[model samples]
Target chain A: MDTPHPGPDLHPHCTIVPPYLLVRLAKLDDPRFAQAAAAARESLLRDSQIRQLRGGEHPFTYSGARTLPARTPGESDRTISDAGGQERLPGRRVRAEGQPAGSDPAVNEAYDSLGATQALFWTQFGRDSIDGLGLPMDATVHYGKQYDNAFWDGERMVFGDGDGQVFNRFTISPSVIGHELTHGVTQFTANLQYEGQSGALNESISDVFGALVEQHTRGQSSAEASWLIGDGLFTDQVEGVALRSMKAPGTAYNDDVLGKDPQPGSMADYIETDDDNGGVHLNSGIPNRAFYLVADALGGNAWERPGRIWYNTLTGTGLGRESDFAAFAAATAATAAQLHGIGGAAHNAVLQAWVTVGVMTGRE
Target chain B: MKVIVSRSGGMAGIRLTWEVRVEEQPDPATWADFLNSLPWDDVTDSEAAPDRFAYRIRCAPHEVVLGETQVNGPWRDLVNRVRAANGM
Candidate 1:
């Protein structure tokens, strides 16, 4: 319900679903959802005013070519941070002394993701680190006790050791870290509100950049890359697949604990919800599938034309804090045309990707 | 009050907990009322001790079993407890 913006930006970001999801939840079968929705709406209204007052200040600063030296390795090897950026002590199972620094698979995964995300911005968009100022990267792996989620807490990224039944150590997956960090990147760039369809797009952008980072890191072509978030975070005990499959949105998980993966590959099947910051994770499947379509259509390395198109759009396009799927689609197409000539493969891929996702046809 | 809620049984395998102190001898009925009044359901059964009452709350995305006690009782109280005590 809190808009990412500070004030007067209540309708800060565009959402795939109407704000009516809160309205719907308010009328849900369960009294709790109704209460939760009512509370969320109140906060949303309050956040609207807050956003109005904090106009035009970037959450993350921009500083090209500035590099902050990494902190000297501290004796207290493990550190954790909360959603609001307050640091916490590490748990025993993930004690820094128990595992060698950067040697732990989780630590390595975090480092690699940070590197890849940083490089993508630097190489493709000329953007610095998460704050675009080369902010010393800070990531907390194994956050919370059996924390089942990973998130960017407006400052640093945090990973969770999944319950190991439905999910594995989030740090095992580079995309997960990249996805979280990209939220910081988004915070700096567009500051997209993490609610409704705009929030979904925000989530989708993280996924898109996440998959790109993985592909770039592995030197995998778009055709070769799995385009799966949390690919390595699923244990053998889990069901048929990884966290969220870009190639196949709804087929990620079907376990009893998490129910079915509620991702939709197309606009027609989009999920509308008020949970998880307006269902940012759930509705992301639509745009995730759209990116997959674009990457597949263009072929070769995704970080090539498709990546360029996206990176250009992300950095250059005047995407509003409230930009929606259609707005994003247009920007991508425009970026593709700008980079690879009008009606080029990149441009065509953008149109085709959106069309496959059942957005507007005949790019205007 | 300090309460520890450990969740070893569940599909998520996530163990999360937070402690709350009510500043008085915790009545089982009052504790039960607080638990029952929650907009959630408990996944595990619980019991009360001389110094504390414990409850296990199971929810996907977050799960924490908890114990509670009066603030100025025995025990130096942990840093987390101190934060909780100070209502941080």
Candidate 2:
């Protein structure tokens, strides 16, 4: 026997409902329930492999089926779908951009995040669009069967729509949308190598802005805002509070299925790994904590000073192609100095944030 | 043996790594030309050594770090192993 190739295994970075949850589902007395759960898990694995193999056909690869105004149109904020709509291609669906509100709030959340991110970049960054032109925001809600992760390909953001067993709908929260869109922003700006600490910084920037976008929209201060990313993505079964907690890193969630929140609260426990774009998602806890510190230190609105500093560093500074955590600290400090002043509170905050994370700036 | 061309840095700012098999050890000229033929303008030499680089080109059982200058013996053997593994 060919040692049975172990079939296919999940990629290190792949997101799915915890296998433990599936085991529970598999143990259910109801035959239909157990069978459905098993089928869902199988489908998720298959879909993840399909996504990896497809490699390029990420959802939202196209603009919406129809076009919206170049700027904000007077259209009401609503969700639209192409259910029963004809398929233009194998996976492509043909539906008007403004058909009707999606029944699921998660779907609407994805759309809202997309729209808000686009608007934020246009209004604040003055970038043309996703590509610095008017590249339409494309998103695929309910991507994989019960998939628990959301990601942005080079083109559009694809949401798993969640299996409802572990996660409800990815669209239930705006931060998830913001998180994915900020990946696009990083793509266009730093184009940070998606490996090692550089990759972690790439992820951290996304989380920083992901939360900021929601806060800005709601006009909530850093203290007032939950400062949690993907707050609504996880279901009640999950033991943790949120997906990732910026204010209190590492406390996002802790459960049997997903295990403990792998994120670190400070730099002392910063993780280092060679998998998943060099453990981009893992080490991001460092920068995520840094942003939280800066926000809290400054107090009041996070978008005002802390957000400006980080945004400037990401877009303005020449971040290293393979930057480590230390390089990022230097850049943020420099960015704050350039934006605020040498001894300005913003600059000091950047320096202090790194210290809290166990990394000092400039031989300090 | 198969030679994998895993380019790490380029103008598109993309760290694209892909592998293609080659039969015999190709002529250095042709191989160099093929590497040069990629879209290079979008990338400038950030560190000024070269526009882009293949940090690690793994040939199945072996691997090599292609530096800026002379191809070392270990690097050559690494390529040979890949070719042999691919049964070229």
Candidate 3:
């Protein structure tokens, strides 16, 4: 009931790939990965420029003028745009609701991913869309020339054709699409501050739903899931499985060019640094692992019990924008208790998961 | 004189740095002339967007940290020049 009302400056430029990974990519000297390096540099430059522009007065505001047609509970309205290898927002309208599949694979992928994400929220949670008000889902593909990342820019989802050498098209990953859209859900709900612990929680929530969408789409139980964030985003040339792994945090990638995956799965390995907004993407491994533990213990579809507990915590009144790991863990435990029972297996599992991840959840 | 430019903030919260030594440039006089025409001391910090970048420019004896909204005119010009010189 008490949703966050963040100031105008609180909205973050939520991107799927962390900057450290891109920085490592930009610093590579191998000739075979020269294109990847160039793309990384370009993405960094473009990201910096966008941040600068956003800081100015009268930052670009979302114009939610286009409304989707009224539909049944399970139906969705989706639109996919093509940026044509340029840096722009909501580019040329290439596909609309009920339109046949397009020629470009990227366009079709975006459309289908949006539908799948919508279906997950609607069918399982009884929520309509990102805003929980049947908002029209919009996306843009081929955003920039070899852009190395994807982002949710506070308005709509934007995907990029990654450097073919190290990364693939962002639209190719369903979990990634779900991850970006979940930022919208967070924006309208918890509105967590995008720095320090809260930022890490923000990132974790997206990863949670992202993994859930993938598992739901594939009809996989918790035991059958891979628990990877960006499984298909990487190319074969890179010696990596995915961008990040919920099952094994730091074991996702250890490539020479991309550097080691810096995620830490517990508080014992928590890194205190001024970089990466106080390690939002890095420290998120702790909570991610906690979720994985809960899902594994429950032994069924993750979106059923674990998903409900996490989602309730996120949208519940107990959450705050500045909530740290302990606070968030406490909230999840309380939500699990409220949803199940005071001393049920789900609540106990939630508490034990946090403790296993080195986060003390009993504190205030 | 030496100039070091650092950029911080953004979605990733990564900081990027670039430096230029005035004496090492091919046209030191030109560089000096460009630096002299700007009102570096009068510039003030401005409001920054959430998750946006701020810049810190240290020109020998003088240093200033300014948010992206504060960048304009000579400051923007100087940042662009330094970034281009460093091939960033």
- Per-candidate TM vs. native? 0.64, 0.61, 0.73
Task: State which docking tier applies to candidate 1.
Answer: incorrect
In candidate 3 chain A, where is summed lDDT lowest over 10 consecutive residues?
A57-66
Tens digits of per-residue lDDT, candidate 2, A255-330, equal 7756676777776787655334445666787888888998899898887678767776766434645667887888
Query: What's the candidate order when arranged by decreasing TM-score?
Result: 3, 1, 2
lDDT of 3 by residue, A1-364 (tens): 1122221111222112235545766798888667767766776767666547634211122122112233554568899999999876889999998999968999999999899999887777766677655668999999878766677776688888987987899888888889889987887667777778988898889889989999999999999999998888889998888878998889888887667888899999998975455677778889999999999988888998899889878766677668899889989998988988887989888988998899973443
Report residue B43 deviation for candidate 3 (angstroms): 9.0
TM-score of candidate 1 to 2 decimals: 0.64
- Fraction of native contacts (fnat) of each candidate: 0.00, 0.00, 0.07
List candidate 3 stretches off by more than 4 Å.
A1-71, A361-364, B1-88
The reply for model 1, stretches above 4 Å from the true place, is A1-103, B1-32, B35-88
lDDT measured at residue A103 in model 1 versus the true structure, 0 to 100: 43
- At residue B49, candidate 1 shows an lDDT of 19
- In candidate 2, what fraction of native interface contacts survive? 0.00
Residue A220, candidate 3: Cα error in Å is 1.3
Q: Quick one: best lDDT, which candidate?
A: 3
Note the Cα lDDT for every prediction shown: 0.58, 0.59, 0.77
TM-score of each candidate's B chain against the true B chain: 0.24, 0.34, 0.91
**Model 2 misses residue A202 by how many Å?**
0.7
Clashes of each: 19, 8, 0
